[model samples]
Target: MNLTTTAKPIVIIGAGIAGVHAAETLRNEGYEGRIVLVDRDTQLPYDRPPLSKEFILGELSEADISLRSNESLTALRIELKLGVEIVSIDAKKKIAISSDDEILEWEKLLLTTGSSLRKLQVKGSDLEGIHYLKTLSDAKAIRQKLDGIQQVAIVGAGFIGAELASSFKKQGKEVTILERMPLPLAHILGEEMGEYFLQLHQSEGVHVITEDAVVQFDGTTQVEKALTEKGRIIPCQAVIVGIGVIPNTFLSDKELHVDRGYIVNEFGETSLPNVYAAGDCAMWPYRGDNIHIEHWDHAVNHGKCVAKNLLGGEPISYTAIPYFWSDQYDHRIQYFGHTKNWDSAVLQGNMEDKQFTYFYLNESGVIDAALLVNQPKNALAVRRLIKQQQSVDSDLLSNPEVNLKNVHVQENEDKVSY
Candidate 1:
């Protein structure tokens, strides 16, 4: 199903960074076809990373973070159908059915539908003051209601929860973070680093409650307090739930292989022909297995890759290294690569000085992932090494005097664990 021979539009079922970038990339690749960008959001596509950071701090506005300029989409001749929900996709007919019974036939379809915030299933979860920050409107609502709020309770201690804690604490608002885990980011960063993060939050004057669950919200009209399972009551005027997000895979039918997200090949194409998926909604091939990444850089690169492949040229495998960063208080934590399991993690520099790089090694002693705190240069070098799939000297990696760029791997020096 080459799009060049068809008259139907190349429809993108999202208007976020990924979808918008795909449309722009298509135009940049000399694709002069009908491109339609559909999104459930009415506002112009804006940057999402700032929503939990600068936006919450009142340092950035929606206009300042707009992904594309006002005339950019029009200049590219891309049609936008904002605030419209896509009901389903007919792969055989190459058409998308909208919620309003509108049919859109497509020469090629890209699903960058993204993800939705995971809702808490506890009692009184539907209370008025409970907030979930995901979209721009969600941020706006939080900002509007945050003024004069003395005691605020934050559920979950992930990225969003931690960032919100920092933001609120900066404003001198008393913030209490309730986490079900023993420590913040325990599963990802390991318990040691998680403890460091916990200490970091405490140093910032943010109260941390670990291994506690909010059983219910206790209030009449608005949330006044949270009742914990441990027989404790956390008094607060507002609550922010930031446990996690679930991929928006509702549109994926039997024809489209769906697990946690829409399954895609190396080229970002789904099982059905002329159908593609990317961003947070797409579970793509990574290394030897399929993984879904919900990061800004991954989504942008995914969109670009899908655009090139959808242009009917040589298929480009979307195997770019995944990167993610988190900004809390004054600490900048940057991570490169992907790994669920690692044999050991070698630490470089001084963790006591709050400046260090940790390398996660596979069973074969090859670096699968590396994270650096306030060390951008080391992060870049590690990213390069990981992309090259090269092994490094563990001694030099642990030695602060040794430069990471000098640690190179010969072809024979690398070995596979399995």
Candidate 2:
């Protein structure tokens, strides 16, 4: 449907970073049709990445992270239906029925429902003091309770888990990280970078426990202690589970091709036509890696691509150079690209000084992925090599004498891979 002519209003089924930007992009792209936003959250669309870091650290507020203002929504004529759950979908009829019998019709539907944190199924899982930083309310409750507590046990040492550890330590809480992995953040950042991260947290007075499994929780009602596989019972007043989030695709039907995330094509079109998906909830082509990321930048770029494609423009496939950032223990960690089975890792600079870049390369000496801790400018260059899938001189990439600025990204026409 050409939006310039008479077009049915676009219906967005989320108020997350993906849905919010998708609706906002439609207006910026000059679509005058009414925009209807359906969300399960009562608060308006706000950034989620900051919730675990800056918001918990007492640096940024809930209002500061919002992408759109009341003025912006007023000028755009966006209709918000908050605290409503979509009951069922009749895609053939182009109509969605909600729990309140509020049926919505649309020319197109964008599913940006995002994700939910994976809950630990152990005992004391439903304890009151336990929390997960996925929503605004979750952050608020955790922040309110943090002041009274001095000891905290965090499970899963991923970005969210590590950031929470950093934030709590700043609040004078004794943070203990319980990670099942031998090295912290090994999957994405590799061993060298992960080791540096482990030291960084420990140097800041945070206790680090590795290769330990939580066999059980010892508490009557609230989580008071966690028993480890090594037979260590650690005392704690509060617990935060950061095991990671699973894409909210429970509402998707068989035609949608749901994996960990809703599978979409290059244009953000699902298996069904006229139905698009984006953000943390959606997965598109990565390079030749068959990888998927839930990064903030990826969500924003994918939403914009969907908006442009919906505008009736001859769709150009989107190939994003994956870039993501994290803040932990006063260090800014930025990573680029998907590293699949790297054969060698080359490090530049000193880890003890808290500044370095680690390059993940294949056996043939091509830079598949790279991560920078406290090196912001180097992140941009590393992103280029990984995106282009270009080869690098192993001698130069490993040598400390070579300048990273001399690196040039190959300009091949890269295709989006699923």
Candidate 3:
């Protein structure tokens, strides 16, 4: 069935960066069909990255981080449904039942339901002061309670945890981080770079305890202390958990292929016809691997790419480079491309100077990914090199004097695309 010819609305669940971008793309691409953008969140779609940093630091307001204004969404002719959960989807009938039992029939369904925060089920988790930051409301609650918070304990030393540590320390609160890994971010950035970040926190006066997991939280009415697996006790008036998130796949039908996430092909098409998925909830094919990236850049590009395919003409494969950034204290961290494994990580510039880049090279010396610390100028060049998939001289990549733009060999069409 040609989706454009149908009068039924194109229903997109989850009004996040992905869903909002998809809705706008549909309209901008000249699709005249009705569009419905739904989300359980009542607030207008807002940028999430700041929730851990600027939002907590009071540098950026709730209105400042909003992705789109009400007026913009209205002008696009997109129907906004807030505070409504998509309870169930009837694949055969092409209908969605919401939490209110309202039915929405669609010519094509796009699942951008995104991901949910992974909760720590430790004892005393229900205590009043323990928090998880995933939404604007979560940040607001934390901010409102900050005046009474003196000591803050952060669980999990991931991006959220690290950023929270930076923010809390800046707020003049005694901050402590509990990480299960001996070296935080070692799983992704390798131990060398991880140690650099671990020190980054310590240098800023934040206490970090590694190789320890929070087994329990203890308090009377509110969390006053955290008990770790290593028998260490951390005292804190407030605790923030940022272990990571699980892809929201509750609305997915059994007929839809599901792996770590809702599985989609290159064009974001799911197993069921007229049904598609993207963003954090959808895992797409990349370099012969099915992967899910939970980041703003990927979501925005993925949503737009999928929207074009939904218009029913020549299909476009989703191949945008995966990117994500983090702000910790005064440092700006930017990473481009994605790779689970690399033959080597070549470090250029000095970490002690607080500015450097780590290039991950494949077995054939091709640049797979790069991590830039306070070196925003090298970002565009690194991205171009990774996408080109051309071999680079390790000597040149490791030298601080060498320009990254001049470090690559001629691009080969036969190389594997990122």
Tens-digit lDDT track of model 2 for 65-118: 887776778778888888988867667888888888888888888888888888
Runs of candidate 2 exceeding 4 Å displacement: 4-7, 409-418
lDDT tens readout by residue for model 3, 1-418:
1444578999999999999999999988888879999999899999998898888889999889999999999999999999998889988999999989999999899999999999999899999999999989999999998776899999999998998999888888999999999998989888898999999999999999998899999999999999998899999999999999999999867788999789999999999989999999999999889999999999999999998899988899998888999999989999998888999999999998999999999999888889999999999889988888877778878888888766544444443322
lDDT of each: 0.89, 0.80, 0.91
Q: Per-candidate TM vs. native?
A: 0.97, 0.93, 0.97
Better of 1 and 2 by TM-score: 1
Residue 105's C-alpha lDDT in candidate 3? 97
Q: Cα lDDT of model 3 overall?
A: 0.91
Which candidate comes out best when scored by lDDT?
A: 3
Q: Compose the digit string of candidate 1's lDDT tens values, residues 1-418.
A: 2347457989999999899999999988888889999998899999999998899889998899889875888999999989899999999988999999999999899999999988898888888889999999999999989888899999999988998898898889999999999999979878778998999999988889999999999888899999998988999999999989999988967778998999999999998998999899999988998998899999999999998899886799888999999898988989899998888889998888888999888876678898889898787678877887755557767888878876666656463221
Q: What's the TM for model 2? A: 0.93
